[model samples]
Target chain A: MKADTRSGTGDPMDGFDTTIHAPNRLRICALLDTAGEAEFAVVQEQLDVSASVLSKHVTVLMEAGYVEQRKAVRNTRQRVWLRLTPGGRQAYQAHLAALRAIVGP
Target chain B: METDEAIRPTPQQARATLAELERVQASTAALSATPWPRWFATVLTLYIAAIPPVYGGMTASTQWLLPKSAWSTVLVLATAGYLALFAFAAATWRKKTGVALRLDVLPKRATLPLAIGLPALLIGAVVAFRSTGQPAWLFAASGIGAAVSIAFHRAFVRLHRKTA
Candidate 1:
């Protein structure tokens, strides 16, 4: 997380996490924050992005330790579910706060 | 090299990002609000409504309906069946919406009271019926339980929309 020194808003950027700053990654965090957990295919569909594109962003998030994946066998098929780690959720929330601050009331 | 100035977004960019995030959240909310199958509510209501009478039957002095031993079995089967139905509903919802139905998503302010009040109502009714030997207590509890289940379903849909 980086402080938004540019704005001089002392405490506002405390949650500004650059790891979640990318557009698709931000959207992913927003969805996971709301849903708690969502299937990968569902996320890909909801985001309306190619699998490769979504996977690329997901890999970045995963590497950042912001998101975790769960693999399960359901309906005789393997399914991957994605959710934010606790730290990831905290970082995402902080980023949201920072964004709101930048946007003002 | 990306300068600090280049790394930070301007206010206008922040506003745009916030708007887009809201759009994504709204879409997720809409998906979550997908209506449960009609039977979901029906089964839930039926299960809740059945608890008191079934419990009363198990503990009642009179054994006219079934032997005292049989009521326990009935209660267990009923509970197992309800759990199975609940699991099925959750699985189907996940398949349909690609999002799992999560009770934790609901506001604790609302769910906490429900978690406590519902069981209290049903169990209280059972205790009253056993002490008084009145069928009316069981009937009243059943009706209220069913109504509460229906109302909760409606409230869940409304809450999702309001949050969205």
Candidate 2:
């Protein structure tokens, strides 16, 4: 799909790139992007955040319909598996576009 | 296809958006300076396999000549050294791979091999640990260690075979 050339202020950056922002969120997305799918604990460990903090942020994005979190059992243990939803991927790309715009070609 | 309602940012908005792009690119670059896996299993293979023999030697060696205190101290020191080396190797591998050491994050699909593996390893460890200073324990440990590596090898192959 083609990208919208608009920004939060309804102005065209002309060549804006979209990228997901927020330090922890960006890190989480980066890990997920590379790792394919990872357990919640893996993301938490990589981000070095406590469970509650991750849960909070994850839930926020999750509620926004950005990230996908699934429940599964591994090694007979319950695991919270995470991946980026298509919507989330789009949002990330859009954010990345915005970031690219900020850098100006 | 282009949607009619797709928003078009004003030049100023586009310029501001460019700033976002800059920040993310830099952040991602900093986040992953190197690509690494959760567990760097390569370097661990050495002491990991060597453990059977080392532990076996400690158990079976004829200690009648040396003082009990000195032998025990030596054994402890050797084990400590092994651990230190393991740590060093792990660190180096991490630096090289840009991946963190994460054993728990192993693929859920790999549980079968792991399930098949843990028993084999446990039996080997039990046999080795239970041996009454017998050479047989070393052999048992060796066999178990081999089987475990084979199982782990299968897992690694499965993971590595996936196309990027």
Highest DockQ, which number?
1
Predictions: Cα RMSD each: 4.1, 14.5
Model 2: residue A84 alpha-carbon error in angstroms: 14
B33 Cα displacement, candidate 1 (Å): 3.1
Distance from true position, residue B59, model 1, in Å? 2.4
Each prediction's interface RMSD? 3.6, 7.2
Clashing residue pairs found in predicted model 1: none
Q: List DockQ for all candidates.
A: 0.47, 0.07
Q: Model 1: runs farther than 4 Å from truth?
A: A1-10, A74-77, B1-5, B61-64, B105-110, B157-164
> What's each prediction's clash count?
0, 34
Model 2 earns a TM-score of 0.38
B4-99 per-residue lDDT for model 2 (tens digits) = 224545557655544444544333333333323334343334435555555544444455335546555665776687678668765664434333
A1-105: candidate 1 lDDT, tens digit per residue: 233443345566566777689899999999988888899998998889999998999999999899999998888999899999998887787787787777775
Worst 10-residue stretch by lDDT in candidate 1 chain A? A1-10
Off by over 4 Å in 2: A1-105, B1-43, B52-78, B109-134, B150-154, B161-163
Estimate the TM-score of every prediction: 0.85, 0.38
